[model samples]
Target: MRMLRTTLDHVRLRDKMLLLYFLCVFIPVVLTNLIFYHVTSQNVKEQRMQDISRALEQIKIEFYREFEDAMEISSILYIDHQLNELLELAYPHPADYIAAYDSYLRHMLNNTYSPVYHSVGGITIYTDNPTLLNSGGINLIDERVKSLPWYSKIPPGRQSKPIFVRTGDGTGEQQHPFSLIRRMNYFYSQNGHEKILKIELRMSSIREIFHNLNLQGSLFLLNERGEIEYTTDPKVDTNAKAVAYNELQLPKDTIEFKTNYVLMNSLNGWSIVAAMPEDEVLYEMQTSRNFVLLLTCANMLLPTLIIIWITRSLNVRIHRILKHMKKVKNQRFELIPGTVSRDEIGQLTGEFNRMTLKIKRLINDVYVADIQRKNVEIQRRHAQLNALHSQINPHFLFNALETIRMRSLMKREDETAHIIHNMARIFRNSLVWNKDRVTLREELELISCFLEIQQYRFGERIGHEVQAQPEDLDYLLPKMVVLTLVENASIHGIEPLKHGGRIEIHFELRAGRLILTVRDNGVGMSVKQVQRLYNYMQRQEEMGERIGLQNVIYRLKLYYGSRFELNIRSALGEGTEIRIMIPADRE
Candidate 1:
């Protein structure tokens, strides 16, 4: 079953559809034709059997007439008074008795009964009387009479009923002639005499019944035990070699005619059976079958061919659409041509064409729009840097000038010159805002210059430290991004303490990400204040302020999308820590 399922799964839709059609149409048609042939053949066979039976009946009628004539002659002789008296009278002399019997026999054989029926051959009388002579139509009974097969069968109670037997050759030959025998009895005289009358019929009488009969079959005349008495087939000699009814090997079709209906006073269970071969009986049916098969083939072939053609034509169009969809999967948008028909496949093709066009247009529009948007974002970040740098420049110059004036009054000319140089370098970095990005080393150098200026202004009260891996020094970030974070921690957290606090700047690499932290120990701000500042950074919006930190957050968002992270931690009188994480692989 699993193998069958796998085979079906691999089969294409066209083959599956064809298989479905075969089951729905051709298989049923073949089955129906088989059923039709079976039913028709059965009906034809039954009809042929009926025809054979009717023919047998007609033959039966013709043969029974001959048998009836023989029966009629026997009945007439049973009541013949003259013939009986002649046999009963006592003869005083042998010559006179013989002469009297010859005259009576001649009269009966030549004029009385023989003239009535032409089928009878000869009639003879066998008697035990001593006066009777063994002449023509007369025989004296002796030892041979008791030895005869019909001698014991003759009725002895004066019934005068006839019995049929085969008469052997009188000269002891094996040739037989059919005969009927009857026992004769005295009516009045007490002569203690007995006589047996035998009438032989010509064998030609039985042969004439079968001659020129219009039938091609075998015929059997069966006797009391259903044994064959006679058969029209010359090959069968039932008298010498008998055959039983069941052993006849009769054909499938047969008809039987019984002798009881054909012969009056018939005591034997005799029947005339006729059998014809099945092939002969069903000749017409075979012709009809051949013609039906031809018609069925023509019927099945033409339509099946036409249906397959149509199925393939429809599938071809569907497969064409499938090929187009495959090309679309590879981003090759091409249209199907001349597919606008009224059918469902045509409609699908039209819809597919339209969809490909829409997809192509959508991709082009989004592509151009995305490039333009990236250019505008870069220009905006550069503008924000310039504006922020220009705004912080004058404030830094005022603080540096005041620090230089204080150092000069204390007579520290070298420190004043160093402060001036650091301030000048800070201004130089601010002026070069054309490049939106710089290496971490460059940004750290600028941060160092800013810290030196601040240290000169605050003296030993303000201390700071910077630590970073040498490998991280070459990593690129937006210009002054680190500097802004350090500046914010100093101004907001460290400078608020009366005893100035220390600021620490650390750069490290962790888990393929760059981490920059700026921490200060001073009077820390409240949680509410830190929360507000972090929310403002996330929203990138503010009403009354455009702080440098906000600018840094916005530029970081633009450069790295969502790949950078910033976190601020602060508490009252403890410290503030700001940690920023960015992708290590960033430019």
Candidate 2:
């Protein structure tokens, strides 16, 4: 997890924006378009299959209608007593049969059932009467007639109902015609001659019915054995002999739709099959697919271009800002030279320019002047310290205090000797100006020495306590800063009280800052006086005092700048409390 954050931190803004675009925009658009294309193509394919199914059903209806008409004609002839009599009549001469045929069979051919039933080409009756003429719709059932394919293939039990069959030579070289044949035995004859009725169906009419359907693919009438009895496929000849369904070389991706012939007894298990290539079934989807692709491209292209433009704009502006920021390290406060826009980056650019200008002015007008002033102040302070040191030699002073302390101890004045010892230590610390910073522990020691000397002067009237954490003792601060505050509290707050007072000094570290609080239970000031003291602390001007509260405030200001804080609270008849806060120096 840390490694990913580190890697991303180093990546440029432009590349990051592009990555976002790829994830949030590009992938989703592509997936959506793909799903849309798949769904649309599937729907189109299914609709095509349905249309083919409907076309095959239509073919079945037309096929049965034609066969039904032929059956009707055969039924009419089955009960025709006149036609039966004509076939059963005996003829002694060919001339007599010709007279009978001219009167009945020829008239029947010209004006009867054939004219009414247009689906049939002609109706012929075959009989085993050798006396009948063979010229007029009647053929003598000799051995040759009995040997025909259609006659020999009839089922014996099918004599009661009309039967449908294809009438052609055994060889598949020529077109075949369909016929309905029935045994005409409704009326018994004296001669007991077997008779058959054959109605030849019109092949041209059936072919026209198939062609007019105008389907997109091949259509076939398959028999019970899966043989192609008839087809509207241009590749197969309609007039040719039947072929096995599997023998045709269909397309590899062909789709077939089949509907069975349910209403006709002769056509049981037969079906009309439609075969269409997969490409043809989905032909219209080609245009739709291209449109979807083009739409997908359009969807992706515009946004990608937009992302590029936006990323480029952001990268260029941000890079310019970064370049200017680098120049700032070399103290080159140059303003960015461009028309600032109203966007967030533009606002950032505007803010940066203002900050640069302010920094440049500060360096020229305030920073250099403040450094020179601080230098002169340090020199004056050092000179004053040197004059004081010249006046009071530190070695002579320490030796004189030691001599006085030994005399007091020799006379058995142990308390006086201790007072002299603490005074010597205070003088030693006051003379040292080489180190301006000291640890809290060292500063507290100096304050203890000064407090001890004051205690000697006031005896039982003055009381003081110093509280501090062991860990907080190492924090560095301006030398004598806390001592000065403690001294002020003792002299001004405690010394004025008749019964005397107690001074408490506490040191603490909190929230990366050092806190030094001094409270005195002595004479307190009014609110107005406390407010006046606060005003004095805030001012940079010198207060005409030596090593007092103002001195401590000034020294803290120089050390910690505006980061240090001071608060003074005093109330009439109550103690005064002073709190000082500064940044802690752990090192």
Candidate 3:
């Protein structure tokens, strides 16, 4: 059993379906045909038996009718007073008596008894009247008649009742006849004048009643004692040793003896045994059975072929899906061909196709996005370096310094060297723009340098303070992100104010994110301007204003993706506060 299970484990779905169809369809059909043939066989046996039984009953009626006719004749003869008187009367001579008796006998036999009963072969009468003449139909009573075997069959007190006898070796050249014998007494004479009447019947005439019955099997007529009285089959043993009824082992509705025929009993205690050889009955059934089997096999064949076709179709579709799945496993995401049907498998195929397309799109989106992200990071670093390099352009610097420092330093010679040295330090730090990120301490130093120069420019009017934890000063941030916010406060917020405002810068870590806020009490913008700046920073759709803040927002987005958050809050006549949040990376 384990081996069988193991073997079956390797069998594919197609083969399993084929095996299931054979068990579910073919085997049942074969069994049904066998059952039907068996039932048909039994019905055939019973129907044949019924037919033979009916024929046997008809033959019985004919036998009884023959005897009934003989009895009627005896009744007529017993009541005939004239004939009785003529036989009893004394005659002058034997010739005169012979003429009277012969005349009466000829008229009775030829015109009355014989004409009425066609089965009667002959009628004979014997009387003890010595004067009566003997003729063809009449006989003189012999003294030895008392010793005949038929004499013992007559009832002692039954003078008019008939009795049947099978006469053996009779006084004629013909075969043995079945006779009816009775005593005749017309009048109650004091001497009790008695006569014997015998009516003979031809066996051929009785057998002729059933001769033309169209039957294939043997038909039997049994007596009341279950003896085989007569049969259409001459080969049957009809001796004195009677064949018992029960020994035949006949079939009722079911044929127990497949090889033997059946004997059925009739209403008259006589069994009508009709039997055909089992081979012959089965032979007839076999022909019909073969026809039925052919039809059954033909019927089963069509569905089996249909099942095979259906299984093959399913196999094709399923195999195609499996093959496509194999390719998907190998990372080749391709849509499978859709089926025209709306069944489950077809729906599954459609879903698979949709899933493959979705996966491909996701993969492509991720791949392209990664490439673009790397390119943006490179551009951000290069643009920051270029901006730093362009800040110290010799032509612009030389012209600006020549014009501003020559005039301003002559007026304020004390602040001139301090501003130049701070400017130089800021420029020197900005020049090292190749690094993608800087420590918060270095960023703070750059902010301080710019703020000190701003103090030189707007000493007491513009003031600033920096508050940060020493531990937070070592944290990393994108290069120039903090410095840009400080520069923007000094140039845009404080420069525009008539009374320059103070700038407060705070850096801290909150919940593993960097919090940087730059608040200034400067000439703050209106809500509309703030909204426009916010929109530019968030959406990057408006490109013409606040280029510094926009550049800071864009760089932060590029460096940290969406993990950073920036917001600005300001109002007319109020200071602006820019708050930035970034992931706290402390290396």
Candidate 4:
């Protein structure tokens, strides 16, 4: 029974009891919160999707109109059959060329033609062993057929067919010109030889088609030739951060189908890929989130006030028990009066006081002797710093890191392991005793540690990228200030996410300022949360536990004299990036 009581007490009774209370309280709150939030988000997501889809549908109207117009023009060219008959009659005639050309012009004038958005540049018919000179001072009949797409693949003695043309510079694959091809039969001369007509098309309307979308970010049209006919903006800053484009297993030569909501779109052997500034979506969502958050915040405070009231009342009872405890501390345990209050804290502390009183009555003299026996140990060894630093071997921490790494590996999480190992290396430095200031390398390692832990905790719901130089790692930083953010991200930002997000960490040297950043791909904080961070930093002005962001912020003020700047950028469910500037000093 004694051992059972000891085990239960050591098993963390306060936390376990609090956890039971919290689970009962938080579970209902979370379910209600989640259900309400999910309904709101679903409606918003569906509305946004429908809005975007409506825009796509509107673009399709233009597509059908353009295609119908092109087909209608093709019909007109077919009906203007006299131009083909002129070339047929003009064939094998030199002086007849003037008469034949005049007939062709007369026929062209009779045809109805409207302005084309991107029309055939001009039509020309070629005849073998034929001669005709016109107003241009050039004869189309004598011109030899050179390079044309499907020129050879085309079947002989058949109607002209649509040709797949490429826009090329015609010089090298490195220097290519933009071109479009559309082919049809205008005329074929009657003889052993054949004269055929073709049109070289200009895609000016294609430009207008893309432009009308008035998209906000990168928009492109990719056709079967891996040709990018249009791009509103080009990517030059970062190469595809995941894989080389050529190495990607993306759908070959077409984006006609897509499974991911945020993936490329394919249509008409051409796909339109668009990326709008995510900030816009987040900005819009913020308006609603602010309202919800205001309510959430209002609701969240009520419980907090209640919990505070409960904690205060509980603390009062605890203080009463402690008052009796202090009196007994000067001597041996002495019995104290038990409280009439039936509350849990009152009962528990009352029992504790009673037990101490009994022990004092039984072992006052013996306990006094035992106290003297331990005095020599404290007097002979007062090296608490050495003991505190050295006694805590990093073996446990390394093992913890190793456990996380090995577990991630077994689960086939390579990226996760990379992050975890990086974090572990940072902790290796952190736990080292007698280390007041870590170099930039060590500081960076610390940041890496925090990032990996966060990356693991967040999973694919978050993305992260880091850019840093080795020189910066040698600069001194207050230990663990950056690392504390990892915990902050988990405890504060990420705890609310329904689907996870991205973090970007960047360091640069600019105008003597050493810039450090930590960003997260989690549901971002409310303005209140953002405001609370400042309060948290101030709250750290009071002594606190070593486990959270407040503790780390405290250390930062100690080292940097509060002259540092921490700039933040974020949106709900969008993500966050924090950039901090500090003077670079190596010691």
Which candidate number maximizes lDDT? 2
TM-score of each: 0.51, 0.56, 0.46, 0.39
Off by over 4 Å in 1: 1-39, 85-122, 129-136, 166-177, 186-192, 208-217, 232-237, 240-264, 274-291, 331-587
lDDT of 3 by residue, 312-380 (tens): 878889898899999999999877765456877788899889889998888887998899999998886
What C-alpha lDDT does candidate 1 achieve relative to the native structure? Answer: 0.74
Model 4, runs deviating above 4 Å: 1-21, 24-27, 30-64, 91-129, 134-145, 148-155, 167-188, 192-202, 212-298, 321-587
> Least accurate stretch of 10 residues (summed lDDT) in model 4?
257-266
Candidate 3 wrong stretches, greater than 4 Å:
1-11, 19-24, 27-49, 89-92, 141-148, 168-176, 189-194, 224-226, 237-291, 316-587
Each candidate's number of clashing pairs is 0, 0, 0, 19
When sorted by TM-score, best at the front, the candidate numbers are 2, 1, 3, 4
Tens-digit lDDT string for candidate 2 (502-533)? 99999989999999999998888899988877
lDDT string, candidate 4, 275-367, tens digits = 455544344456666666676667667876787677667766666677877877786465545545787776787788777867766786687
Query: Evaluated with TM-score, which candidate comes out highest?
Result: 2
lDDT (Cα, tens digit) per residue for candidate 1, span 455-496: 876677778999988878888777788888888777777677
lDDT of 4 at 225: 43
Clashing pairs in 1: none
